[model samples]
Every structure is written in structure tokens, then in C-alpha cells.
Target: MSTDTTTEPEDASLEDLLARVDDLETRLADLEATPDDSQKMVVVATKGTLDMAYPPLILASTAAAFGYDVTVFHTFWGLDILHEERSSALKLSSVGNPNVPVPNAIAALPGMDEVTTRLMRKRIAENDVATVEELVDLSIETGVDLQACQMTIDLLGYDEDDFFDGVTTGVGAASAFREMVEADVQLLV
Candidate 1:
């Protein structure tokens, strides 16, 4: 005679639990087989003004610090960001800037842009914020590749010598686009 005392429902529940465990194990194995997706970053700088220039540099350097390969492609007006003569002196515009306390009408007044630019620079200095030059240096030090847009340089009649010393190369839009498409994170700023 058999002495097994387990009920039919209890045995069925045990089988269900084992099946669920197997399903979960399979899922875990699939997850383990997947490759990492956090490798590259590409940033596009389209504007050259002081306010517009900081984002690409800051993000590229920060990503580099996190061990991601970083590239910043400068195009059009953004070419000034890589210009040796103007990178440090890019000015913040008060016109149409909602963050400024002054009304748009007042901000658009003559010389208001200069005033706002001076104020912004003073505030940045007071707060120990990194200037564009410093951020560019940091990005370069962290192995961020700075690229100038060749089409823009040619259109604007600027020579390679016009760019800062840290630029890795001058490339066309297609090259920059390729980098953007390949990057895990692509930012346009």
C-alpha cells in the first residue's frame, strides 16, 4: 500500500510554481545575453552664442567623464564655438530671452544685449561656473572629439587655422550625421 498523503491540487500547484520558475530563468538568460547600450554620445552644436554654446561642451565632457566616447560636431553659426578668436567671447543675447527680468521690448533696446552679456558673464564667474574655454578644454582633456563642419567652414570662407587647437578634424554633414546615427545618445543643441 502507498503512504503518499499529498492532495491532487497541491501537486498541481507545485508543478505550476516550477513552470513559472523555469520561465523566469529563461527570461533572465535572455537578458544576460543582450549587449550593453551605453557606449557612445554625439552632440551637435548649431548655435554659436554664449548661451547656446555651453550645452554641447558641458554634455560632451560629462559623458566623457562617464566613460562614453563623446563627439561634438559644430555647424553653421556653431562654428564660432571652435573659432580660436571668438570662443571665449561669445555673447548672450537678451533679445527674446524669457529668462531675463527685463521685458522683451526693453531687452531689445540698443546696448541691452551688451549689458545682459556682461551681467551673464559676471554671474557665471561669481557662481564659479565654467566658461566656454574651460568647458572646451575639459572636453578635450576627457577625450571628447571636437569636429568642425567642413561645408560651413567653406561657405563662411574660414580656414582650418580659424578653429581652436583642440579640434580633431573638419568633416562634412554626412560624417556628422553618421556619428549621430551610431551614437547611443544623440543631442542637438
Candidate 2:
């Protein structure tokens, strides 16, 4: 021991490190015994024009499938996606590009948004995609929860009951924002 006196400091440092390692081992065991955190996901949809819908609800539904508690909050143009009577009226833009896959291509020509929508309505029988209405039907069948923004609904003079069946209530922006606070993942689709 006297010959290796210089190594005393190294021995003491090693002992201290070993003690800390033991403490960490206990903490790791405790954590392993605890339950996993419940994952959260929030999806927001905006823009109700042709070809712009289906983002938030689909993403939310998919996230919920992965065991994450999912919530979809619709606002502004996005709210149109959840309309019970009007959702079927939605169309896709197919202008300037003929090969693009759109529900109703004629609905988006130069300053012809409205005209395109009208044309789409006339040809609804022949148009390919099932339209937003069809998607909503399938979405509801899969147990997806859809929520429309209260502020937007009121602003647009839409009745609360007029939204899709899955929508139970309308919520203000503050409440929507609060819902995202605990979310492990939040996205604006």
C-alpha cells in the first residue's frame, strides 16, 4: 500500500463512481415498473377548397389507430369537410393539368371556381371520386371522431347539429388550443 500511495486517489474515484452507478440502477428499475405515458395527438384542418380536405381527420384517425388518443379540430374552410348536408358538394380541382386525378377537374379553371363547382354538381353522377360525402361516410363507419370549431360555425351561421354525426360538440379556439397542451404530437394538416 505504501509503494502505491499515488494510486489512492484513483481508487477513491472508482469507489465513488460505483456508488453512483448503484443509485442509477435503482432508479432505472423504478421507471421500468411504472406504466407508459398515454400518447396524445391533435390534428387541425384548414382550407375547404377543392382538393384541400381530408388531411386532419385522416391523420387523426390513423394516429388513434396507433394507440394514441387522437383529436381533430376543424376550423375555417376545414369545417366544410364535416358538414352533414354540404360535404357531398365538395369537389377537386383539375385545371391546367389534364392527367391529375381530381374529383371534378373542371371545377378549377381560370376564375371558374364557382362554374367548376356547378359543372361538377351537374356531372356528379359520372365524376370518379366518391366526393367528400363518401369519404365522410367511410370515416364515420371506422369510429373516427370529428369536431367542428364553434367559433367558425357561429361565424358562418352553421347550426351545431348540422355537422357530421360523429361531431358531438363545437369548441372555441381557446379550448382547441388547450387540448393541444398535453398532446405528445400536434399537427395542423
Candidate 3:
């Protein structure tokens, strides 16, 4: 059988539809050409536990790998994520973590935190996952900006020496807020 070849219907409706389609395509191209929100990402790290700390560091590093300008603002307990002494030793807090197999009462018992933390670290190592210290180094090497919360530092009586080398001068929440406002993507991890 021969293939059928037909020209346009030569009707106003079909012509109008084609013109609309062209307009839509042009607009779609314009939209695609515009800068993506992922161009910049700001992550707030506010937890110190092993389970809670990885997300911001991981996301910041991943964004940096994508050539995004990424900043991780460590506040409150999250300060441990960048602490030179504690970063590698950040413990899993099973007391309130629902994912842990232990009941809350058992988890809250003395010595349970140590057990849980060890188990978590063992699992992480077994899976060949990067440690917090490794992720911190990777993030710095990849140009991820890390900032410590000045207020928390003062409140916790922590000196600048407590943090790793890559952190910027401590920043208060206001500065972090300004960065967040300018960021195309923001996360509290």
C-alpha cells in the first residue's frame, strides 16, 4: 500500500491550532532557557546526631558536584557536623528515633546510645559509605561553603578552634537568612 501524504487542512481552526502550538513551543523554549532554581542551594544543618547530620552535608556536596553554589549553615546541635573533635564521633540518638528497633524506654536506658551509635557506624562502614569527616572534606574540596552559627558558638562556649578548617567566620541567623533569601533552593536538614 502507498503511504498517504496530506497537506494542512487549510481551515482557520487548524491554522489557529498550529499557530498556538508554535507560540507554546516558543514559550516553552524560553522557560527552559531561563536559569534553574538549582543554580544555588542553601542547607541548614540543625541536628548533631549521626542520623540527622548526613542529609545537609550529602545534599550540599551533591549540589556542588552539579556546579551549584551550595552553603551549609550549621546551627544548634548541627555544629557537631563541623566540629573537629566531634564530627567523626557523632552518635546516633536512638532515644527518640522511630527507625531504631529498640523501644523508646529501652533506647533511653543507659548505654543504649553507645550501642546504637556503634551499630549505626558499623552498618555505615559495612556499606562503604563515606563517614561524616569524609563528606566534610569532600564538600570543602568541591567548594561547598560551610558556616557555623555564631550565636550557638557563643551560647555553647565553643571557640572557633572547635570547628574544622573550612568553616567561614561564624555567622548569625540573620546572615544565614539573607543567604537563604538569595538562594534559588533552600533546605533545612
Candidate 4:
């Protein structure tokens, strides 16, 4: 003869498990109803070049237009995009850019960057594409958060006044990281 020794959870333990599940479901419903339900995007801009500047700004503005909460964190050389004066005068470098038809030898020549920038500007105008300044303005008007890194600003000796009117200057990396952590989309440009 054989005896079965299987055991089941106590009735009290099963009741406790059901109660915990109920609490969890209630908390989840509350979270789903909160304002945090909106989609979020965080874009990290680390390059200052004119060509490099467009991607982040365009993405941020587009996301904002689509009703997503968007934040652009500009650090290192990327801070130039927020600089009121520098942004307007940004130039595209032909050197080391594979897209440019010019050979590296000729691209390395003096004034090539200026020529490339002029050509790019003409193309943008011909295509009726918005300039960097216009995109920045639109992003601001659409409520996209443009944050400039405090460390980069201090390192470059830039004052808050140097940035555009709506830009949030002197923001720390930690704050940007917090936003990134909560964002549904994170981009490093």
C-alpha cells in the first residue's frame, strides 16, 4: 500500500495572495488613469554641427506635434544648437562627411566648410525646408523642452543669456537622465 503526501497552500495564504493581487490591480488602474499616460520622447544631442543639429530638433518638434511629451538634452558641442547667435551661424563641414561628393583631399582645403554650408543652405531654401532657427522656434512654440547641460555651459563659459528665449539653460545630466528613464523613446544624436 502507498500513501499520497502531496500538500497544498494553506487557506489563509491563498486568501492573502488574492488580496495582494487585488491591491496590485487597483494600483495599476490608478496608474493607467494618470496624466503620465502620454507618450514621452527623450533626445540627446551631442553634436554641434549644422547637419547634426537638424535630426534632434526635427524629431523633437515632430513628436511634440503628435502630442508626445518631448525633451531635448543638449550637451558638449551640441549646446551650439541652443546658442542664440551660434545657431544662426552654424556651418556644415565637408571634411570626413561621406555624403559630400567632394573628395577628402579637396574637402580638407580651406573655405570648404563655408562652401558646403552655403550649398546646403541653398538646397534647403530651394526645397522650402525650415531653417534651424525656425525649427527651434517651432519646437519651443509646440512645448518641446529644450534643455542645455549645465556642465557644458560652465565648461564653455557660456551664460544662460546666450541661449534662445525659451530654452532651459543650466540643466544637469541627472535631470535629463530621469526624463530619459521615463521616456518611451530615447535617442542619442
Residue 91 CA displacement from its true place in model 4, Å:
1.0
Question: Ten-residue segment with the worst summed lDDT in candidate 4?
Answer: 1-10
Candidate 2 per-residue C-alpha lDDT over 93-117 given as tens digits, one digit per residue, 9 for 90 to 100: 5565454444434535465555656
The C-alpha RMSD in Å for every predicted model, in order, reads: 7.0, 6.2, 9.0, 5.0
Residue-level lDDT of model 4, residues 28-136, one tens digit each, is: 9998888466899999999999889999999999999899999999999899999999998899999899999999999999999999999999999999999999999
* All candidates in order of TM-score, best leading: 4, 3, 1, 2
How does each model score on TM-score? 0.77, 0.61, 0.78, 0.83
lDDT of 4: 0.92
Look at candidate 3 and tell me the lDDT of residue 134.
94
Error of 2 at 53 (Å): 0.9
lDDT of 1 by residue, 1-189 (tens): 543555677898999999999999999899889966569999989998988998899889989989899989998889898888888779888988899999999998999988999999999999999989888888888899999988888988888998878796558888888988889999888
C-alpha lDDT values of all predictions: 0.88, 0.71, 0.89, 0.92
| lDDT (Cα, 0-100) at 155 in candidate 1 | 89
Q: Return the TM-score for candidate 1, rounded to 2 decimals.
A: 0.77
Candidate 3, lDDT over the whole model? 0.89
Checking candidate 3 for backbone clashes, the offending pairs are: none
Candidate 1 vs candidate 2: the lDDT winner is 1
- By lDDT, who's the top model here? 4
Q: Is candidate 1 or candidate 4 better by TM-score?
A: 4
Q: List residue ranges in candidate 4 displaced over 4 A.
A: 1-35
Clashing pairs in 2: 107-116
